[model samples]
Target chain A: MPTSRMLRRATPWLMLAPSLLVLVPFFVLPIAIMFRNSLARDNPATGMLMPEITVANYARILGDWFYAQIFLNSLAASFGVALLTLLIGYPFAYYLARWAGRRWLPVLMWVVYMPILVSVITRVFGWIVITADSGILNGLLLGAGILREPVRILFDISGMTIGMVHRYLPLMILPLANSIAKIDPRVLAASTSLGASGRDTFLRVVLPLSLPGVVAGFQLVTAVVLSDYVLPTLMGSTRFRILAPAVFDEAIGSVRWALAASLAMVMLAIVAVTMVALNLAMRRLAPWARGL
Target chain B: MAVGEAGLDLEIAGISKRFGSVRALQDCSLTVRRGEHMALLGPSGCGKSTLLNIIAGLDDPDAGELRIRGAPVADVPPNRRNIGVVFQSYALFPHLTLRENVAYGLKVRREPPRVAEERATEMIALLKLDGLEHRYPNELSGGQQQRAAIARALAIRPVIVLLDEALSALDKNLREEMQIELSLLLRRLGVTTILVTHDQREAFTIGDRIALMHAGRIVQVGTTEEVYGHPASSFVLDFLGSASALPGRVEPGSPPIASTAFGLGFELTAAHRAGLAGPVRLYLRAEDVTLSREPTAVHRASPARVELSTFLGALKRQVIELGGHQVLVDAAAGHHGPRFAQGDAVYLSFRPESCFVLPEGE
Candidate 1:
């Protein structure tokens, strides 16, 4: 082959070399190291990692019902939070994209996006303040004579779910709003003019078209909620053992690095399988975004 | 008051709309008899579209009454108004197949599944869109998409159909072909229809009556011949086609005489002369005037110079400068007259009755 033709062929790979350089060292190497570490054995007395090649860590995690239950609980919480966020976010997104006039849309966007700007710790503290026994919610219910006593909210699943929804709502809404906005207003008009009511128009046209964004937002929110550490620690009861908190406990308190690595690998596997499944669902449901 | 008549389909009365402070429509009123095709024709931003949107119930009028059949429906929502619309962009549901898109209205109305499918199939065949029903809108050609849009609108058997510049998106040749095909289809269906268009030629091809609009008001409404041949105003004449106007003074007499500053004179028709005085504007269609190399003593011929000659297919458009006034004359391509160059001297003449006289102020 001519040198010029060889150079031309080399150009594309050369352009891609910088991204590959970062990926190999930062992502691929770390994952490989983690997988190797997960197979090592820990000293029985000190719980320190030792050089070995075994599936003991995986056996410990899979054999123990406590660890399996923690994993299931985390997956369930993330799935629940994703659904709740979507239910709350979809209507607001629709309003912002379609009905809110120019005058109020900017103001509404600021409100929707404001929580994201605040640190998650600070927002979680805000949730604590509001849901605490002597908080404003309890005070309001007591003052309004709607309750006999203050209701327990903080340090419970409800508090954790609420915090997760608050943190991930804007994530769900932004994508949904964008997809809804791409729909030509004329299509809505054409539907209405063809004797389809507003409800029918939305069910038949708007919802199906906006499914790609919904699925994308669901996957993103679910992944974030699944692996979240700080939120579960702050808002959840100590009795509740989600995967992230358990991994932290095994590594720092128990000094079981192998167990922690194995649990981390399991979490990674769950997220990977979920993302793949969600991607397949998006393609099947909204094939319009085929390339993406 | 007589809206209950069986022949009436749509009757709009004293309709007005304002977008913020700009008056988008004002007292726009028109009536369409059953099976009539009314074309709302105007230039862009002329409020023809605003009026159509109001009639379609997609937009509300500040003050007006709209009646479909015999009953008022101003307060009704768009979907409840029982009207079908074909938009300029077609606005086909991108996610649905052609069959699904056509069946959408029926499905929305909660027609049984079997009935909706049957109606969609019928409409597809009606539009000659067979064998392409399963394809998505993006997969179809422009003309096929257009036909699909029409089929979708007609599937519900709407009381009336509204086409909003529906054929404007196609190429010129295809647009003309669709225009004829659409006219024949509408005739066969005998559905009351209103077509909003900016192109006068399209209006002429499709509309039973052309309603010329200007600045948020309907200026003239009549048959194509009535509106084109005897325009009601200077705007109407100027909008409909190319015509040269000569500002002249009218001398009152049993039959008034009009003479221009360029020494051209003509006798005005009786209707044009009634209760009129002072200056007048006389318009002559380009095709109405003939050009010759030599002056004919028998005709009222005026001297001119050929400024430019443009070959327009079978007709040669010769721009004649007559006494510092420019007028276009369309001569036959095979005329036996000597071929005229850029600066050739010529004489222009036309039948005097063909000239239309309007008030000078207009």
Candidate 2:
């Protein structure tokens, strides 16, 4: 028989326990294992794994210039792509949300988001044709007497950057559009009535207030670019490597699970820390939007 | 000297807006004197908000002129209009601190940060924002948000302050308190203010002059006393204060008087002669009728029978029948006067000045 006192206290935990049980193994266990393995190193002669932990995985990545270069390369590619996406995507989303047609919203939505359904390889293929030396973009420019020769538009950081933006553009656009849509048309009026010119209102209130969405987009684009593999694999060459593919190469192809696990843990930590920073920046800029 | 920096003279001439076939406003016009508080009182969808927006330059009227002081504002945009509007919803920047919200317009004016800070601090002090300057709109209660909104609007020191149902969001008690405080603030500042509200009490309490609008037109505009006591039309009388409508006609005489079944006879006073006519409606305030014991041949006294009396805390409301028509009367509480009960004969009298008559064509 369950006492009333026991039932009162025990019921909440009983209800919550199942969810925690499911989450720990699926989500938390993998992370914990990856973190633990990142520290472990085996002695080759003993042919036995030494559970003895060391800062070796971190030190190895930090110490080697080759690995350090890859990490910086990853930062440059992700940051570059995310910046371009924000610059281009923000206005596009704002225009569509603030001024688009009542009936054409669905049509516009389809146009903007249809790429989400297409395969990454297929999308990258289309970009290759468009950007290739003899392909549509070059042909158009050459026909117009703009370029004497086809530009180097493939197998480089630029091509990968373009591919990354194409893939992550939607992620930036949706959050941005949502925030812009939430602005009361009245605030714009209030802004102007306060002696802010059209440009000033947009600059001071609309743009600044929308910074949360901008930060969110930036974090998402960076995080997505960081995690991505296919865009780089297809559009980029081996000369420029990112942290994700490097780790993947060691873990699966080179059959070094310990090193890969350590890298994964590092990647996760980087994401968490960067997200916290972005969140802080977002709060600082659009502290009012949190109230909404 | 009557006008302040922005010059409170507001002239909205022939302003009109139409959506599809529905005309939200058609040639609406109004004017406010410098430093006077005016209320645009109306029912919902009467284009009161549309008029406020026109004044704010949020919506340009299709065929009208908006002039602040004597300057035409034909091409002026909302931000450039230099008017401050506090919305019904408070429209506070939720992300901004109370002080930041107040400083928005000052910053827009390119005021130095220190000056803006000083002005914002002054407004915060004026509005009694005190230690709550750091609180966000969501953190404050409804009344506090309204004060912050007031502070923000007034901090700009625009010529005309527009209040679009600013107190509608607050609870009844808080709304009344804010209304009094806002009225006092407007007076102390001597800034021309236009308030839009559906609540008549708010309109009467704050407005020196009131305009009652209905169906996108100004039904009447005058001093609250003029609009309330001497309603120009039947609508104005019925709209502002509660009126007991009784159908009647004027008896043939040099000094015309109304003969209705509701009462024995009602003579038109000097103020109520506008409706001296053959056939018309008589609007009598419930409180105008006085009940007295038994039958008495007195000034404007007519014998009547008592029907019902109700006690309403500090006042007693009674219904006495005069010539088969029921007349309502209110008096001091706990009055057992006339030893009144159901079906007792009595005398009811009303000063000729208490009733108003509207012309028949209306």
Candidate 3:
């Protein structure tokens, strides 16, 4: 019985052992090695990494205006994408959670995630075709007289944003819908009966109650967009610089492993700080959402 | 306006609603006097809740006129109707503390912060939730949460209060306690309140007048005693409480006689017969029928065999066979009377005035 009791406790960890085994060596070990490499120096003549503990790489990136501008631009883009997805996804999430018929909800949800089912590269190519200067969007806009001429969207930040929003919208919507669905419909009715207008009820009750989901979706989109490489690389022109591509250039194009590792560490630090700050803000702004 | 319309606080006239092919409410009409407590009593799905929703302006009726405080509110939205509703689930905002929940309506109305705080505090105290104001709804017990919800509803001081099966979620003891507390509080506040419930005892406890509903219609509306004693139909008799029904026919006479199918006959007053002349079902409340070991001349006694006797704490309930029909009898237990066993022979009798001779197939 003693042995069996111990076995019962150990069974969970034993089951988790496979994933841990893979993660520790292939994921955590690489991150640890990367952190070590980030603190090292590159040999000037040999073009090879030297095992040295130094902050020179971090110092160089932070001191240089060009590198600092890339970091700021990446942050701004990530924030913008996160906000755009949330603004566009909220009403759809509200409809799905509160108004959609039970029979159609699954079908609607599948439609929302349909774009994700296709390969990202394929989706990027699809976006390229749709967002070309004389693409369908431009044609429709021109035909409707909304635009006097075909606007430039290809190889621009707007095109990159469109592709990214299309790719990441479902991530935002899933959590928003989940939290909104957990809200009791009767609570809304109670609000109405208590002399709160529809707008007031939505702003004072529904929005506050769904803050957890908003925080979750925002954090997810922010982190993913900050490190997103494919969408920007495929959609953006060569002059458009961001941390993800800069890290890539350092690691593969120039073979500057130390600089690449340092850039990746900075990106990691930004993501960690953003997640922590958002979590703290959620706790402060909507404390009742804690544990929910 | 009619003669009595001036004193009315709320009036629902000819309200009807249909969901697809199913009629939820049909030409329902009721009027509540100012400072009156009316209980909408019925079995589940009897259109009581639908009527309540229409009154609260939460749902629209197909054909109806609703007047609150002598003003037509057909075009008014629920928020502007100035009605307070306590939902069955309580529906207190889980994100808000008890104090904030109570003050939400005031905040919506843009009342001064100090006044809102004062009123919320007063309501919290009135509902005995003073110390627990800082706790969220999920942190409170069911009874406490229900009190908080009531406090929140009452904080706005609306023209009328609607309670939709509000106490159905509480345990029996807590429900009974809250029933007394809520009724007393509503009486003190003098608010025209409507309580919708399926529990007969709850209706009797909280309602000054009971509007008994059946099949999407208000079958009978009267005082608690009147509705219980003089049910308009067999459905009302069956729904209010347990009863023993005997199929019979009404025999015409100066005072009509009710004759059962098995040759058993009993004299009935004209008032008890209620104009049912042909086939009828005589319903007798279980407590109205009494059992005795020996025959007595105080009332008409029928000889019967006790089929089942159950000692239910304060009362001894026995099922007796009379004229090939089972009749339930309840006698005071532990009294100076002979107790009957399962097969004991006994005499059953009940006052003719207490029996309801309703028309058959009603």
lDDT of 3 by residue, A63-125 (tens): 999889889988988899999999999999999999998898999899898998999999988
Tens digits of per-residue lDDT, candidate 3, B39-92, equal 999999999999999998989999978899888888999999889999999999
**TM-scores of the models, in the order given:** 0.93, 0.87, 0.94
Worst 10 residues of 1 chain B by lDDT: B294-303
Estimate the TM-score for candidate 3: 0.94
Clashes of 3: 0
How many Å off is the CA of A8 in candidate 1? 8.3
Judged by DockQ cut-offs, the docking class of candidate 2 is: medium
Give me the TM-scores for chain A across all models, comma-separated. 0.91, 0.87, 0.94
As a TM-score, model 1 comes out at 0.93
Query: Tens digit of lDDT per residue, candidate 2, span A1-292?
Result: 5698889988899999999999999999988877888888745454344687887878887788987787788878878988999999988888877888698777877877988999998999999998877889889999999999988777878788888888899988888888888888777777777788878878877787778778889999989888888988888868999978888787667666666777777777777777898888777766666756
lDDT agreement of model 1 with the native: 0.88
Name the candidate that leads on lDDT: 3
Candidate 3 is graded, for docking, as medium
Compute the lDDT of residue A142 as modeled in candidate 1. Answer: 92
Of candidate 1 chain A, the 10-residue stretch with the lowest lDDT total is: A283-292
TM-scores of chain B alone in all candidate structures, in the order given: 0.95, 0.88, 0.95
